[model samples]
Target chain A: MRVLGIDPGLTRCGVGVVDVEPNRTAKLVDVVVLRSPADLDTPNRLVRIADGLEAIIDEHRPQAVALERVFARSDVSTIMGTAQISGVAMLLAARRRLPVALHTPSEVKAAITGYGRADKAQVGAMVARILGLEAVPKPADAADALALAICHAWRTGGVAGAAVTDASAPAPLARTTTPAQQAWLAAERSAAVSGAARRLKK
Target chain B: MRVLGIDPGLTRCGVGVVDVEPNRTAKLVDVVVLRSPADLDTPNRLVRIADGLEAIIDEHRPQAVALERVFARSDVSTIMGTAQISGVAMLLAARRRLPVALHTPSEVKAAITGYGRADKAQVGAMVARILGLEAVPKPADAADALALAICHAWRTGGVAGAAVTDASAPAPLARTTTPAQQAWLAAERSAAVSGAARRLKK
Candidate 1:
């Protein structure tokens, strides 16, 4: 199966394609990026992003779409902007009826490098080395998008796990629970965030 | 001066190095990744991360360090773990007195790709193309961490703005000011987040 990973941005969104082999191996196929103007209105920007996503999907024909999950930032505008971008991505994938999976940025790093803290160059090198390529991926976001796809492939057992160094690492996160569970968990997070925000306000 | 970018995880931490010439051009030098045992406890896991960071710094001797800033996660456990890893990165950089800059994932992505919404593969491709490399960087996290360093170089005008694209296409984000101004406005983001949290609670 071919998987497409997206790093959605309002101005500059990244797209990467990885083909997963029957033996559970993934190889990089292509990466495309476009930068939108900063001055566009929000709806216009989303349209631009949707256009980019459509172009990528048309070109790559990926069977599945994997996205990096949203993490809360201290900046409201940044967080809102990211959510809007993410929403666009989800809408695009859902429109195509493609199965979508979300991975945290840390999960992607950990899955690719066996180190959650690995940097971009390290991830590029690992991707290159894993595929026995001549060099690492460029334009870091492209590489990250690829990594997200790869991580999904690995998670789904579509790729060989032995090559991933942290195959035995404890699950970095809990398994998928019910919406109720998720809500409860999120409530705790909301409380923590609120507490921190209140403290920062002072 | 060479700057090493690190993405820290309990089991795997990605590392990447780029030589930032006096002229502000960043050339990829090396990327390394280390994997720790999956079952190690919190303290031991931190030690593993610390050791890996030290080793990378010693081998690369980077003049500075750049990392993706931690954001709040709904999972308290995950957030705490991320903070711990961040602390480990900070400690290693501090030991060497290397100036460390923390960037949000979007900032790093924006710096590397023209759009903050750019995906991982696009970022990787950009990294490769900008650095004049032939292939996408591997293990994606390494590439992203490295991108953070590259973004810093670009933002500091080290590359004379060569690192970022000027696509000027309509972006999904609605920014009223230039990115430089947007960056300066981040200080107020904390307050905005706090207010949003309050509104969400009601």
Candidate 2:
């Protein structure tokens, strides 16, 4: 399947398209950086971001959207900018009803750099080397975005091809509760812990 | 080819292995969560994380490791924790001499959700549904990890299968660049702009 990976930002959004096959070899289709000035007002910037996202999607028409999962509390400005950028992407994906998946930054870095904490440069270099390229990708943001795409392609291809061994373990989903339910349970657990601590102290 | 996606954290690391085929379908071979409690010292945690990673790799034997890219502020404490977790992942992959790729969170979310701003629950729900599961996956982290694998599978499959349309486009290697180069360019640009501004004022 063709996976379209995007690194969302209000000012410098990056998009990458990658193709994967059964043998685990991956090819880079298209990778580009789309940027806007940070000075632009929120609404206009968002619109521009949306337009940029739509253009990439229209051009690529990928079967699925492989996006990076957001981390909260990165700072208000950063978070807001990221959220705006992310919003544009989701709007387009939902418009097309395309399935979407989100991955964390560490996950993407670990997949590409062999080090979860590898900086952008390491990731860029590793992405180039992994694909058997001679030079590291340019514009760190774009390279990072491409790395995201490559990671998705590799992991998804492995899963889809059934190459991973099951190890005869039961599925985790079998006994797990949904997020909403888990939240409720978590509250109860905390309350109980507090109660026990109070009783002991008294 | 089998792709392994790892979502690294100090406490719980989520790992997923997926196999992709020529026709663009993914089959889950294995998914697991590794836990290293905060009660353990940093070194012990690192050891635990490393051991868990090695064990997973040994069982799965993925051709490539796709990790999420982490970008943290210069804050000492946060950076240290991130570094340790990332270091373990890197050590594991490097020990095996396996190729690795890193991607930012925005990129992964965009790839999967077509919107960089997708919420965790939304991402989890979509991942489950895309894999043809009955409901959303639990422990948001695990689902995100799985999604990362799925994204990699799709992108790389297209590349390896020669499905990409733009042969003229830069290959994956073209974008990777060292941070020093980027810094130098930024400085140069700033100087040039300052000179231009002076000229304009004159």
| TM-scores for candidates 1 onward, in order | 0.42, 0.41
- Model 1, A24-55: lDDT tens per residue? 46677888775667774344455566678888
DockQ category of candidate 2? incorrect
The top-ranked prediction according to TM-score is 1
Instruction: Give the per-residue lDDT digits (tens) of candidate 2, residues B1-202.
Output: 6777887776777888877675556677787777867654343455566677788789988876766655555553444345345534643564465655555566566555555566686667656755767876667768877877776555454232221111112232224333554454345336534543234334
lDDT tens per residue, model 2, A80-192: 45644553464456557555555568767755654567678677766676566788777877787777777665545433222111111132112333555446434534553
Q: Per-residue lDDT for B105 in model 1?
A: 75
DockQ of each: 0.01, 0.01
Measured with C-alpha atoms, the lDDT of residue A120 in candidate 2 is 80
lDDT of 1 at B147: 83
Model 1 segments more than 4 A misplaced: A159-202, B1-202
Indicate the residue-level lDDT of B49 in model 2: 65
